[model samples]
Target: MQITDFSVDQNLKELTEHRTVVLPVACYVTTISENINGYIPLHWHDELQFIHVVKGTANFQINEEPVAIREGEGLFINSGCLHMAKDENSTGCVYICLNVSPNFVVSHELFTTFVSPYIQATNLQYLHLVPKDAWASNILESIRTIEQYIHQSQPFYEIEVSIELTSIWKNLVKNGIQLEFKERETLKNQRMKRMLNWIHQHYAEKILLEDIALAGQLSRSECCRYFKRYLNKSPLNYVTDYRIQKSQILLQQPQYSVTDVAYQVGFNSTSYFIEKFRKAMNMTPFEYKKYRN
Candidate 1:
């Protein structure tokens, strides 16, 4: 399998790289320490995903809830769920990621009955798969087998992989039907995504708490509460963090001086920007730029 990095657009939807046009599926390995931020940034996609931790432990924030999957454990993320992952131990983490389009796995008739319901179920955001559980173990094993088949590329591997994927889907539907419904939580998650998207788009501008709340159609207090709940930070803090992240890219360009990067990323004062950047990255902008170069 390919080792790849993730890229996302303004809406935070991941631009996934597929293995083949016909299959609409991709399997790859990623190391948490290798990412730009030492973690996978928050993003979502329409495809369903399964992640198996191969080394160390992976800490994930899925739809604002924290879940940890250790070595030999796996996780199933529903379609379009906002999620991010990082290494829990700080040593590093190796994991296999499989992304598959739901439509490719089932026929139109079966999709309406067996697939759409689970994908559209707001309360069913993710499932943490552990090897100790019989059913969960079966699913994890199937995921491993699918990866092996794809990597080996033997004759009729596509057909064999399809059968394995279909079996996984059946098991997911059978088990996920029991989760309790919580439409309110789902709506909150959607609002949070809207606010996050606005922050990413407007990070280069002077953003206010009111602007963020307005983007999400929420009251200022509600906005603050949601940001704290979902991101564990105040809205303004999140904005500062985002601006610092953006500034790191501009720092790489020799044409842009430290002062220029600070202003470009919405900081009015270079000293203030340096202060924040150091706190977040443990290095000043100039130091980081020099190290990167």
Candidate 2:
């Protein structure tokens, strides 16, 4: 399939706009050096994802944990996990990513029996697949085969891809049945999602720490703890970063002046916006706009 970038909605749900037409699977190769930011931004989706590093090492954050996968290594991200990745070194990192929908991979009865438990397992956010482990190696090989099959697009290639995917899923279940189910992690994830959604929705308006905490039903301190635990940033810091992120998009358009873009993204002071933008991006908003053009 063709390579494509993805966007998320206010609630951080991936829009799934680039899946292949014939199947509920999307396969693409990503070269981190080619991206303006050299990383994929944090996002989540309901589809299961498999990623294989093909070149330099890739560093990833899955939920609250960090993982690094080197060349020839792979990772399995469970459904509903918040994740992001970046090139570990300045050198380019190339990887193949496949996102598969459970419904498309199995019948309803089979999905209930095989997929539901894993998807709902809060303690099992991700699995790092290495070549040394037998089961993980098998899954990795199956991923490679699926990537080949999709790239070739031979007759009945879809069926071949389906078989490989099933094999990977089987390996995952056979090896992952022992993971403990943690309801607390589930609740934590839910609260974090609520707070993040609130931030995204109100990012263009005046937002306060108490306002964000209220959206997640959290006190000010608990809200700070949760943000630090999951996102490694304070609530106000996250809001500033998000505002800067939004400003990047607006800066790409020629019609908006720097001050206009700054205010549009919730920064009340144009000078303050310029300072933060420079700190985060290492360039002024005007310079970034010029660079983009």
Q: How does model 1 fare in lDDT?
A: 0.84
Compared with the true structure, what per-residue lDDT tens digits does model 1 show for residues 160-271? 8899889888767666456555778778878988998898898888899999999899999999998877778899998998888788788889899999999999999999
The TM-score between candidate 1 and the true structure equals 0.93
Collision pairs in model 2: none
Span of 10 residues, lowest total lDDT, candidate 1: 1-10
In the range 1-293, model 2's lDDT, one tens digit per residue, is 32434568988888965356588888888887565554787789989999888899988988889899999999999989998887757657888888998776666779888888788887789999998988889988888888888888899998888888888888888785565688888888888889999999999899989999999999999999988877789999999998988888889999999999999999999999999999988899999999997
Q: Measure candidate 1: CA RMSD.
A: 1.9
TM-score of each: 0.93, 0.95
Top of the candidates by lDDT: 2
